[model samples]
Target: MHRIFEFDDIIRAVLQHVESSATDLVNVAMTCSRLAGPALDILWSRQSSLARLIMCLPQDTWEGKVEGCCRDYIVRLSREPTPIEWEHLRANASRVRRLVSIDGFTDAPKLPRGPVLRRRTDGIGSALDLFRPILRPDVIGHVLKRLFEQFPPATLFPNLCELHFEAVFGLLERSSKFWLLRQFISPGLQALRFDITGIPTHEVEQLFAALPTEAHGLRQLSVSAGNGTAALTVPPSLGKLPKLIRLAIFAIDVSLTRQMITNIQQARCLQTLKLNLCGTSCDASGIPLELPSLKTLYLSEGSLSQCTHFLRQVTTRQLSRINISYRGSASPAEVTAFVESLSTSCQTFEHLERIYVVDKSDHPDYLLVIPLHSEIFRPLFKFKRLSSVKFIGIGNFELDDRFLKDVPIAWPSIQELKFISWKRRAFYSVTFTAMMSLAFRCRSLQTLHLTVDATQSTTIPRAPDGTEALWPTQTALRNLHLGYSRVSKVARVPYFLAEVFPTLWSFKFYERYLRNCAADIDLRLALEKAHSQLGALRNSPYENSDKLWENDSDDSGT
Candidate 1:
């Protein structure tokens, strides 16, 4: 074979591009011996189910049946496999690096969903009816135990690096799957994620207590207590993971939240931490916790007070991104306090690049009129490197022209800026002129979503000599979402927008903001026409511009 093919790295890289296409990989393996090893390795590197490895055994080793009201596909060992069958299984099992088992099933069963009445002469059923079933936790536990007796658990998948096991069964059913999950854990494992529902709290505690010894090299871990389960306890020994770098816990409570924070301080290498507090409140009167290595933090399903408390305690200068989501309403003072804590926690704002603060509640009656005043957002303005900022589901923002002009100067590197309100307001002070200031100053801005007062007539500014003033065009901006923004003189607005944002393609506004108004409908149609015109102008040559405009007007009339 060629010298390039002799190098395993080159062959592996070539095989990875076609790894998703099993047929092509198989063809390459069968075509050349030099390519076969790498091809087969890539093919089995990531497995979503264990059924393929089981089928590698002798055809008669296992029997399949469709059972239960859900028509779950199940398999049982009819007879023990011999030495030759075991060898076939071992050949491919060693190649797996990532194994994922979701919803207590390895693979989606391909068997017929309709009921089968006929039975074969052997009394099992038709040949086609014997396809793999949705393996239950109990059935999988039995099959895995029997198979492990033939081969040691550690030797089954020695090269496995990542394992994601999720099952949505009840207490007893999930308890059985835990055994199967334990067999997959090895010292070589680096990442593990579990999302089992209805499992007892003690079981979760025990699993984490043993992780340090079972998987010493683990760097990333994520666990979620499925719906209706109690808060997950944070085992003290979980901090013993020497190489742990990323950890995410969902559906945890207040006291355990404090314990979790205290426990993870021992994880010196941790860089990413995510917690879902389930809207529980906690006291913030404690010494600040320092996470020197943490770079990203995400907290969700928390109350405004709870989220503020967590931020106040966390002192991480290296943090680059923070996503905070709370459920209920918050007064202006409470919102300011939360933002103040965030700024104080991050010692230096230079490292912070992205900030996402959202209020997930949608009760219109609870909406508050939080003015978009400079003083309220002064803390966030210190983050010079900020790139993306999103605030969704918040109450009515009393926006004005001054705040809009100040935004560009604060975060010049901003790429995406979104401010969404829950209810429509009758009046807005900010006009189209203020939005143009952002396009002119923040050249890198791409996505912008804000409500502005566009009800005035569209007129191009003129210079002292009576000629139209030249304004800088922003080509990076592609999407503009004006939620619940009122607009009038819609005919000229589209042409004015095309001048400022030459490459703008998407212009969105809510028509339901004023359902009975005729102006809102006209604005939507005008924006639609501008979108079509810009799209065609970009694709066509300059010589065809006139022809395109002619076609645009003809289409607009209809």
Candidate 2:
């Protein structure tokens, strides 16, 4: 018994690294009765599919194995498929705490939606594949209904904590499906993820309305319109989930934004909200929604101004993190206005921690420059608590050294910083002293990414006594990625970088030159090899290895 417990501990350790750990535990359960109970308990704790578990039953349980179809199915019902003789399933059913429905992949040349797909099983495999639940829409609906009917009760999975269904709305919205679902809406259920693609808005609304009132423990709900333009209707019942904490909506029509906002406003304990292409129609009312507990909000792909408009309506003073992304070309003025509005609204948030701004425009000719030194970005500097900031521009954006010098004062807590520009030259050359000033001030800085010119010849920054100015050594910085600007001496660049960031274990020089030059190519390759060598040297405990540095220089032929 002690050995069994010890082996169970090993299984727990293995589970942390592998998603198939439950399956592995199940295999171990088959070895002995002593191990079976505990192993099965863990194995059946979270099930991605009920069919997969059902298939584990003996061949006798299968009604009749017929050959023609890709997979097998229960043609005849026996004893209404009760919990008799199936000891393994009956014993472990109570352990199934999660149910996730797998999504189907339509192959090339999508078949027009109809019964035409049910007749064509030319390349479809056998019934054993039903566990994956990826079948013709009609077949999926039928099999799921049959399986749900055969499912025992909440007693089988008494502690089910989460229910996740992906692209399985056909089965979920079936007239009889709610009765089966009601069995699993135990008080222990804390999360619900439903992806209702192609399902009409009315059906989705009905599904939400059917949710059990006893869902007090439910804290997280993520729903997305699967793959189509179906604007999912937000059921007022969503606002009624007592402990609801996080909500995410994706690819929903703009027309429903008003109802969605109202639904979110009612969730008392909501902490995180994510909107991805969720709205089309912008609400002109700009009504304020009070959400004191909300801490994080992410917006992507929707109308940039509309998203900001929604943000303007929220009074989440405790909000700490904000991520906003625009997929298409957005005017700089509009983007700047959004930032300015956010900065003004959250000016009093002393706990603001991270801000990530991304412009995902694909147009090469378009460039959106943000002058950090100008009044447009002045409001952003008010967040003194910022730890991580990422600015990914649409094309190119200039970042002057004068503006960078104040980064430490603006966000002294900054640890991870990324400024990505798509232009050939986006950052003006800064004296090594000015760059080191940032390192000196921001002691906790670990990851830094920027692009700049390094080719200009200038006097080394020194003190009045003519001694080279020294900055405090930054021990936390481990990764540095700098855009390759022209360097007067290519060989000296790495040494300069090594001096600036002595603790770096990963250093990458990125140069985006339109027309590639052979000498430039050679220089980059050599620098890459040198960076690897430096990384290895830094990782090594033995520091006094002049021979290793010599060997690296020799290899680079410098």
Candidate 3:
């Protein structure tokens, strides 16, 4: 035996690499007496379903049958398994650290909306087929509940720590799934993701209220309710969890939002919060809610006023990221108010790094015409540490070269800056000069998306010595997306880009806007030529390729 295998930590570490492949882990386990326990322990640590553990019981204890019009394979419990037969299950059950209950029929044929028909089969089939069959969640729940009646329930899965209970389809009975989930909620459980899409609102409330008592050590919890379902209320008992750090809830109403904020006020350890507000208004009656340790916040499915109202009432100095998505058109005043709320509510702006605001409304006429001025975005300029700023489908921005110049100065560490509008503006004042400003100023920038008027001729800035002011390689920008930006001198554009942003490799444009336009066609061809040249240069063995920018002055029309 090798000395490396003598160390249990080393053995476990080696097994971690092959844990994803069950066959490899099983082979390792059976390879030798020394590797068996650790290999099996690694194999059973995380389980997607309860099918495998149940199959470990005596061969006669349960049987696999292929029945019903859909021809679904299912495992059915025969007589109750005695204590001797339960040993195999108990051994593996003790190793389980995470159990996720997704729908059993995820890959199965979509049957007509009706109860699944079941037919018992004679206990005879291919050994490989009978080895493991998809166990119906409801049947497994029933069998497990029956087994718990005979064996000690508390000791079933002693090491289980994480449980994700998600059932989108209505195949599993509410009672059975909940019962099975409840049995896994031990004091040591750290994370729980409960997607109660089909579960009744009252039942969801009841289960949420019982979580703190059932799993006091829970550090992360996510609850999601389906759209059009009854609104879910946040139970006060959930706030009692001492170590809760992250919480995300979907499809909640205004009243429940207030309740959630009020309940989690003193949860000082809470770091991340995501809420999908369902109501149009989320006014918290002027009373401010403070979360001292919160670092990230995601607000979606609310109106502009509702999201702003919610933001104004919260104070978290440690906030680093905020994502807000709302429906309907937002006026300049509304956008200003939302940005102002962030500037005021967050006492310190140094920690704030990312801000993403997107409009979900689909009406192009109503959404596209709203013009947002640079003054409306001035409030965010104070956050010096801002790295990523993304605004999608909100409205058209009247940005120019001057505003682009100030952006890099304001947010020097900015990496990803996107201003994506759903509709293309007929005319844009921003020219390639704005692009040059970003390439020269923002050193950390990796992704840039803007609508610039490339049709107009603009001179590249020159240094005092009369050379083109270029960062040839310093600029980290790799992806540049020109969104409906008009371009006429396509042949000169690519070479100019190579001179300014040598590292830029991915360039994208809205092709729909290119229909029947000569300039658009030229622009597309120019980009393809640049990509081909870059590919050839990268594949070449030359140490220094001067030909990269040799065609910088190419005037030949595409």
Candidate 4:
């Protein structure tokens, strides 16, 4: 004879199991058919604090397919309802707040009149004769216009701290009361990202003017322009925002940036600024180089000459972080000149090493009159305090002897380094083992990321030596991201844990480089296993949950 555990005891154990595992309950179910029912029940029956119930409103089934899933769940709950079921459905109101974001405009909810009417002859028991008349788009539009006309002292949605909208609503020549985008910023928003592509300039100006100072005084504002400079303008009212801090704008004309920064500087709280110029020219009026409080600044996809010139004007005394992307031919003299201009406070802050220049600028595009290995970075190695450096589009420059030898000189105080290239693709002549051995000598290296276009190699490289020590290390090296399999030697990730460096914290061992792909259960399990293995090193503990981001579309297609 056998005795069954109490239902409460079973639930407690299941909850504990779900909590401890850095994986999904669905993955746990897939491990064993016997565990499937209970594990799925745990995952589905439990409602997320922020989203809906997985069992009742299956995320996959939310897009108007199977019209009455919610009704079905109601039936199931009413029939065999357990204690957990009740807790999921009613206890969490946020989980049940259905979001029906419009593609081009806005609309409000209509009151429900019991079950949905299916028959044509369904009589005077209609939705029209409801407890109160439900407002339609036009009605709400008129009412909101009158309300805004009044200009009340306060608004609602106090809990609304962030508003990240991606300009899904196509623009019109004029603003409509129906387009109550302002209302969306319930409480004063702290963070806002606007995808203002294809919007007319006057409309942008109108909206900017209409927005109240306190309503969306966003501390962090990222504007991605699809059309061009027309989407961005430094509103006069922006200067009055109390807590505007971080600003990140992408795909806008660089000329518009100066006005935006001028407006930002008026706000005493502005700190971090990032400007992304994907395809536009950097001839924008010019960055306001004299920001008193600005500390961290990132300018990507601009000519390095422009960057170096811009930094020369700015006072880098308080600046801590600076990231510049390669866009033009910047010579070794130019890079070293900029480094030489850096305040001693910015450089030797941690007192590590001499400063240096690492220029892998390939061109006709200016073909190297001076070889990349010798003329460029070698002289700058004398001043080694500069720790960080980046190289792009250099597939042929594998960890060759000359290439490998340059690393020690370029990054003397280097603690963090990232290399994304096609290493295995072009390094056929260089033996993989020797290259690996050379890379292991960097004594001060810590976060290292090397991703190859593994699509270049058929399999891992098998050298005369048993295996390439891909992750060889003896220093405090931590955080390894070796993706796209460079060689056919190791069956799996090599020296990823303490064997490489003891203090390694974060590690990403991606099998395939697929972005926004449908998540597979096995792949998720493997990722969780790899993520959890960081505990073997002295790393931060990770929790078992998907990083749910609030994407622009209400539909979770991507």
| lDDT for each residue of candidate 3 in 242-348, tens digit (9 for 90 to 100) | 89988777767865566768887756788888777786555446667888899888887778878888887788889998888787788878988998999877989
TM-score of 2: 0.75
Question: Any residue pairs clashing in model 1, and if so which?
Answer: 73-133, 73-134
Q: Write down the RMSD of all candidates, one decimal each.
A: 8.6, 9.8, 8.6, 14.6
What's the lDDT of the predicted structure labeled candidate 1? 0.66
lDDT of 2 at 73: 31
* Candidate 2 per-residue lDDT over residues 1-558, each given as its tens digit: 446456757655644443344444444554555555554455455554554444544434443233336543323323334455355555556776656443211111111121100111122122111222323222234545555455555666677776765433333454554455555565687877766655456666666765537667777777766542444556678888878877766654555566667777778888877677554566555556677778887777765676667667666778888877766655667667777777645636587788777765455343344443234555778888989877665435555677677889999899987765545345454543455566657899987766555554433457889897644467888766665443444334455556666877656565344248786786466545655556555664212222321121100100
- Each prediction's whole-model lDDT (CA): 0.66, 0.57, 0.67, 0.42
Error of 4 at 388 (Å): 4.7
Give the winner by TM-score: 2 or 4: 2
Using TM-score as the measure, name the better of candidate 3 and candidate 4: 3
| Model 4 whole-model lDDT (C-alpha atoms) | 0.42
Q: In lDDT terms, how accurate is model 2?
A: 0.57
Candidate 4 error regions (>4 Å): 1-63, 66-156, 167-178, 197-203, 209-212, 227-231, 256-260, 278-288, 326-388, 394-413, 418-444, 447-475, 478-558
lDDT winner, 1 or 3? 3
Error of 3 at 276 (Å): 1.3
The top-ranked prediction according to lDDT is: 3
TM-score of model 3 vs. true structure = 0.81
lDDT of 4 at 402: 62
